[model samples]
Target: MNSDPNNQNNFEHSEYFDKENIHHKMEPVTAAFIALIGIFIFYQVGGAILTILIFGFNFENADINAMRLLTMGGQILLMLLPTLIFARFVYPHHITQILRAKLPQAKEVGIFIVGLILLLPLLQSFMILQNNLLEQISSTFPLLKQLMNLLDQMDKLLEKTYSSLLKSHSFFEGSFVVFLTAVVPAICE
Candidate 1:
């Protein structure tokens, strides 16, 4: 058995430093707890700060329309910044190791594409069925009807500008708006 420092006991050191199998490297429960705390703090405190900054601590029914745009931009940045910072600083090593896994095979990618193509129509059909069921239930259930009324009240609280922004659309136009709202945010994020 060669006892030279460089040649001896390669397996022993390899076991200690191996990075390929990241699933084995479990995150501590404490870390998860801290991450949750961080998220809560980020959201609550960040939202409060933004509200105060934009609206100047108004308790009454203050007109907030001018602040609404700034609020949206600030809220988005606040939400994403904490998560990004935590992931980068607190667990960079673990994240990088996990992301080093092999890329999806061509067949897997093709199957995923086919699955999505099939899924869209099925999802839309499911949603239509769900809406019909809700309508039927609301006819019988006063509570469900009241809930729908409450939702309508909430919608009315939004500005006419926002309501108009939402309502000025055909099906294709609505789909395009939804796609831009969802996909652009995801891509930018």
Candidate 2:
């Protein structure tokens, strides 16, 4: 019968805000959309401003190490931060559960490693076959070639960015590159 919505007893007894249960929070799709918007705003706007502040307008010509640091920082800020925020909004009290706040089992780790090793050759072979098929199809369809050209431009840009980020000047730089490309994304994505 408490009139105040902020009353602890009222919130505690409310089915929707039950502390013991993780349901009745925001819709998963709604939370996903919010996170997507956050990613766009953070990556496109905040990231651009940060880039300019760090390397000025000519960021393309910035030092490689600086660019690597920027890429890592941006991933943490724009990707991981938004994801955490999404968890907080959707599962307030159960954020850890939502984010899988636990170490993986050794068996799980082994399976993941073995899966990656086994999948690589299969994937490479598939890619070769796919490319050959696509080439044949594109030869008969000019529109497909134009679409492929657009995709190739995007792929080239991504490759250039990855290549730039992977460059290292020392052992420490190489270690950081691995952390940035491997560890950070493993946690973020």
Candidate 3:
């Protein structure tokens, strides 16, 4: 054994826990590209899952409640998986730091809720303007019109899915649906 203070132990001088001095094997640009690719692939996979579950099963041929459940699963995959992968894999060491995951103060939470409520109208206005602009552009361009039509159909499908999900006869059923659709996703994200 070495008789020097620097040679006290192999683990003591190791760079693994020395995060400040750590040099990641993956470059920032490479990590970003990986994240983007992961997001794109996961989104497509989620969409494919939704399509197979929804159209393949033929929701109209079965119970709408079942269709709603399938849609909820798809939504979970779409919203959660990519986020988790990007957080854990792309930035493994700094997951919480990257996500800014921390418990906010009550005042901060209240402010955030109030800010969101105030901003809703502005967001809606922006969406309305965007839709109007797209419509105007679609009218002038044939390809754009087709794209817009496709988007419109998708929107209608989403509305129908939401309706199916929200159509609850009992208070307990409604509460469960709200918790599933809103609370769970909010917590996951």
TM, every model: 0.46, 0.67, 0.66
lDDT of 1 by residue, 97-143 (tens): 43233445689899999999999999999989988898899999999
Most accurate candidate by TM-score: 2
Q: Model 2: which residue pairs collide? A: none
Q: Which lDDT values do the candidates have, in the order given?
A: 0.60, 0.79, 0.70
- Could you report the Cα RMSD, in angstroms, for every candidate shown? 9.8, 8.6, 8.2
Worst 10 residues of 2 by lDDT: 11-20
| Top-lDDT structure, candidate number | 2
Model 1 whole-model lDDT (C-alpha atoms)? 0.60
What's the lDDT of the predicted structure labeled candidate 3? Answer: 0.70
| Sliding window of 10 residues with minimal summed lDDT for model 1 | 17-26
The global Cα lDDT (0 to 1) of model 2 is: 0.79
Candidate 3 C-alpha lDDT tens digits along 44-159: 78777766766684544556666656656665677576677656765666665445444566898999999999999999999999989988988999999998889988888768
lDDT (Cα, 0-100) at 123 in candidate 3:
100
Residue 132 in model 1: shift from native, Å? 1.7
Error of 1 at 171 (Å): 23
Per-residue error for 131 in candidate 2, Å, reads 1.8
RMSD (Cα, Å) of model 3: 8.2
Candidate structures ordered by lDDT, highest first: 2, 3, 1
